[model samples]
Structures are given as structure tokens and as C-alpha cells.
Target: MPSTSDQTLENQNDEELNSLHGKIKALRSVTIDILDDSNRQNDQLDRTGNTFTQFTNSLFSTSRHHSRSMAASSTVRQYRTIAYIVGAVVLLWLVLKLWSFGGTRSVPPDGVNGEYRI
Candidate 1:
């Protein structure tokens, strides 16, 4: 049979080992929870990244289309301005020519007496 001192030491050793085992199990559970949380965060980050990329692509395409339209509109406006300028110049030239030709004519004898000049 074992002595009293030996038995006491054996019991102490068993208690220490049991405590260590319990601590190890608790640590394993905590590590598993940390790993699960990390995986969830990674998934969320990927989704957010994808959404941002799509939005950026859409914005770029819209801006490109608007720029093209604006360029076309500006070209049309330039043509219209040129046409108006040319028309005004032609009208002024015609009016001046007509005025010079009409002023050089002689008046009739009936209109020279007391009637207003036509």
C-alpha cells in the first residue's frame, strides 16, 4: 500500500492535470470562434469590394456617354453660328447694293412739282 505522503502527492498531481486539460479545452473553443469571425469578415470585405468596383465602372461609362453627346452638341452649335454669320453678311450686301442703285435714278416731272418724292 502507498504511504500517506505519496497518496497526497498523487492526488495533487491528478488535480493539476485535470485543471490543465480544462484550460486547454477552453483555449481551443476560443480559437475556433476567432477563426469563424475572421472568415465572416473576409466574406463581407469581398462583397463590399465587388460592389464598389461595379459602381465605379457604371460611373465611368455614364461619363463617357455624356462627353460624347456634349461634343456632338458643340459641333452643331458651331455650324449654326457660322451659318448665321454668313446669312447676315449676305443680307447686308444685298441691301447696300439695292440702296446705291435706287438712289442714282432721276425723278419724273410730275413728282418734281409739289408731290413728295417716291
Candidate 2:
């Protein structure tokens, strides 16, 4: 019952609708892929957070253990600390003396004999 012109218009509209349907399907597929990727990233982040938490707990435990051990007899005694300080001072003085000696070129005075310079 439709005229030729109406039939042509109806066919064009049907073709446009099919094209739009195809585009919607593509968009849905892309959205689903994005959702899957987001979920994967979230899971990875959660695992990393758990790993960090475990590491923090381990660090705290080690720190507490170290403090406890240091409180026991492993700490440096007073005489040992004093000896160490004295040894360090002597080492520093020796190093400075050596440095000063290295910087000076030993030359005999104009009239002084080389044998007398030692």
C-alpha cells in the first residue's frame, strides 16, 4: 500500500537503525573491558597495600627487638666508650700531623747543610 518514495524512506530508516545497533554493541563491549581492567587494578592495589602492611609490622617487630637487646648487656660499657673516644682523638691527631707533614716541602734553609736538616 505504500508509495515508492515511502518504501525508500522506510528502508533508509531501517538501515540507520541497524548501524546504530552495531555502534551500541561496540560501546557495550568497550565498557565491559574497561570495567574488567579497573577491577584488576583494584585487586593489585589491595595486594600491594597488604604487602606494605606486613612489611610495616615486621619493621616494628625488629625495632622492638633491637631496643630490648640494646637494653640488655650488648650495650657499650662506660670504660669501653671512654677508650674508644681516646683512641679516636689519638687517630685524629695522628692524621692531622701526617696531613700537615705531607703539605710542607722539607727544604734546608739557604745556609743549612742537608745533613743537618734531618
- lDDT (Cα atoms) of all candidates against the true structure: 0.90, 0.88
The positional error of residue 52 in candidate 2, measured at the CA in angstroms, is: 0.3
Q: Candidate 2 lDDT (Cα, whole model)? A: 0.88
- Reference-based lDDT, residue 75, model 1: 79
Tens-digit per-residue lDDT, 1-118, candidate 1? 9999999999999999999999999999999999999999999999999999999999999989867866778778767867999999999999999999987646554644655456
Clashing pairs in 2: none
Q: Give candidate 1's TM-score.
A: 0.59
In Å, residue 68's CA in model 2 sits off its true spot by: 0.6
Candidate 1 global CA lDDT score: 0.90
- Number of the top candidate by TM-score? 2
Q: Which is the leading candidate under lDDT?
A: 1
Instruction: State the lDDT at 118 in candidate 1.
Output: 62
